[model samples]
Target: MSQDQSSVSRRNFLTGTGAALAGTAAGLVGHSLFFRPSSAGAVKQGFEWPWPYTELDPEKVRKKGHAGYYDGDCAEGALYALVSELQENVGAPYTYLPVQIMGFGGGGVAGWCTLCGALNGACAAISLTSKDFYKLSSELVAWYCETPFPSHTSNELAKNGEFLVNKSNKVFKQTVSNSPLCHVSVCKWCKENECGSGCPDRSERCARMVGDVVAKTAEILNAYHFGEFRAQCSESDLAHSCQACHSKESPYEMGGWSRGKMDCTSCHIKGHASLVDPHHPGK
Candidate 1:
């Protein structure tokens, strides 16, 4: 009964128009990636690395995750559904994946809302299927930044469901997130939709995002398998202005706690820089 909506983000020149077109074409090709045969009876069972990308019904995948939301939360729901689908088709070793192990990834580990459970779940899937996990997962991380929330909505808007109705009493709409961290994503939603972190609507919105991630994971993985995939990291993926000062590659270290794929402001104050932005010293 989630509110229904369609979502699209502005395709920016921050990346290239050519790359966007290519990505669209690759996505349109629709899930024909080469699956390398797995080691254990993989040849016999006809399994492979880089599982073929399959076209997903966003609502179908959303419903799949939401049905299990109460039981396992976001990471478990999404990861289990995707892996289960592969196992059903590929059998054996594919089924050997420990799906429940992903539960810790949600809500920034136990509902605190850190790294997105969607990325956490999808990354686990990428690690299992691709040797190019970094490149593959990078695509996902970038996509999360570029995409809007609740990108797909349920078919029927159930009034009884946890739908966000703004002060105007209008159903809440989607917004693009420039950050990959769940904490930021939730905060933005709370501000724009006029909802609280603990609201049922907030939880539903994030849960619905899982469906988009799973669908996109299939798209990117499928493209990766077929050799059509390209890494699409945009300048937007970085807080490059701050990276020189805060990145792990920098001389300073924070024991890896103040580090990750997030936008810097997701956790830090932005007004002052500890170090100069070498690229733009005048600023």
Candidate 2:
């Protein structure tokens, strides 16, 4: 072809490509605008701090929690079970929640063995739905420490093939950790059951524990929603006694060195000889 004819063809191709690109960009912009909510505030209100909550069935949540454990481990499972239920029942903001955000909490946060993942997930769910997050979360930790793991209800469900997922159908032994630490909880259970932490029996035990935690969380939320929630547990007498001298408000300067409501005996002995005596100087 002649040089002039070839140049004209090249120009035409460039023009057509530019037009197509412009059209595609415009279509994308329009698509986004079309899907935008008509009233941003209306939708935003649902996501306001401490999202709205409604009563949920403990049994239903328990089943979901058990199933979620198989898929996302403890933390994700616990949070997903509650938030997914809310997503179905209440819709909107609940639907927008990324339920897997707490997945890192599994095995006490990347296997560091800190707080139990089940409790971590349930606490996040509580924070999302309740204004009294701290109080309710404390109650949850206390209940976990004091209440036996693999509640009778969960064991019965497992035995009867009623749980959503049944990795193991054995009725496992139950034990109280007397502490919320994941390492403590798992080690105690493993020691009592005579099984390794990685064993299927332990996995089943954790799954059942997730169910119990989620069910209890649902119950607490339900009670609070109905204005019937009461503090079922509180700081142990030992904790209170230790805090009297060491808490933030302690009158003695040496007494105000530590704080928190967790059981003191869980990680510390009843008494320490190394502790400084406020009454005696340099003793």
Candidate 3:
């Protein structure tokens, strides 16, 4: 529950900290359908970082992580998806850290539902592998915002997963979630896709997105291990235009905060007009 300031790795202070998701039962459908997650599950006495890192197949991880989502939780799905692969390949810390610890990150801690739990899983991956977590996290987040997602399609669960949705008929209608917040991202996708933003489906969408995040994170870690990881997006790749007009740098600043290559409407709902309309000036 507490740690000394000198100790650096703050996986202890992460999103899913309690025993498991609250207000949920403790059985097969209790929450941790895969593994029983406790706040103390992943933590060991005098635990320290620079934890062992292994490179698993990114494409393989994409498949497994998505299936993990079907195990009934987003963060857990991503965690088991990638971590299990690492355990299969080269096992140690993977054996140590349980994927169940991430169960509370769906929406937000304890189902309060804020930041996308998929992103939380990615953060966990960063926390486990890299001391430069912020650098990797920042870049990963920017890419998430920029890319239209649930970017990949899913049909079958096997290694040679079948493609159900052809290029012609729509299956997953993708949307770019400018912010990492779960509700915003998933809701926007539903609206854009004309799916009407319902249950299981929205949950399904986030679950798939979890696959993308986890698999991409695997690629990042794999490349980092192989001397191929490069940070291509940062302060410059983020929102220079929006910041110029709305950030403190501008005389027209709206006391603006946060920076990224996201849509202008990701935040401003009413007080300000949206820059996203097709008829807008930029278009």
lDDT of 3 at 16: 42
After superposing candidate 1 on the true structure, give the runs of residues whose Cα lies further than 4 Å from its correct spot. Answer: 1-59, 152-171, 244-261, 274-283
For residue 214, give model 2's deviation from the true position in Å: 0.7
Write the number of the candidate with greater lDDT, choosing between 1 and 2.
Answer: 2
lDDT, residue 210, candidate 1? 75
lDDT of 3 by residue, 69-115 (tens): 77847778777877788778767756777788998886655676687
Q: Show pairs that collide, candidate 1.
A: 36-48, 36-49, 107-113, 108-114
Q: Per lDDT, what order, best first?
A: 2, 3, 1
Model 2 lowest lDDT segment of ten: 27-36
Show how many residue pairs clash in every candidate, following the order shown: 4, 2, 0
lDDT (Cα, 0-100) at 214 in candidate 3: 83
RMSD after Cα superposition, model 2: 16.2
lDDT of each: 0.64, 0.83, 0.65
Superposing all C-alpha atoms, what RMSD in Å does each candidate have to the true structure?
13.2, 16.2, 10.3
TM-score of each: 0.66, 0.79, 0.67
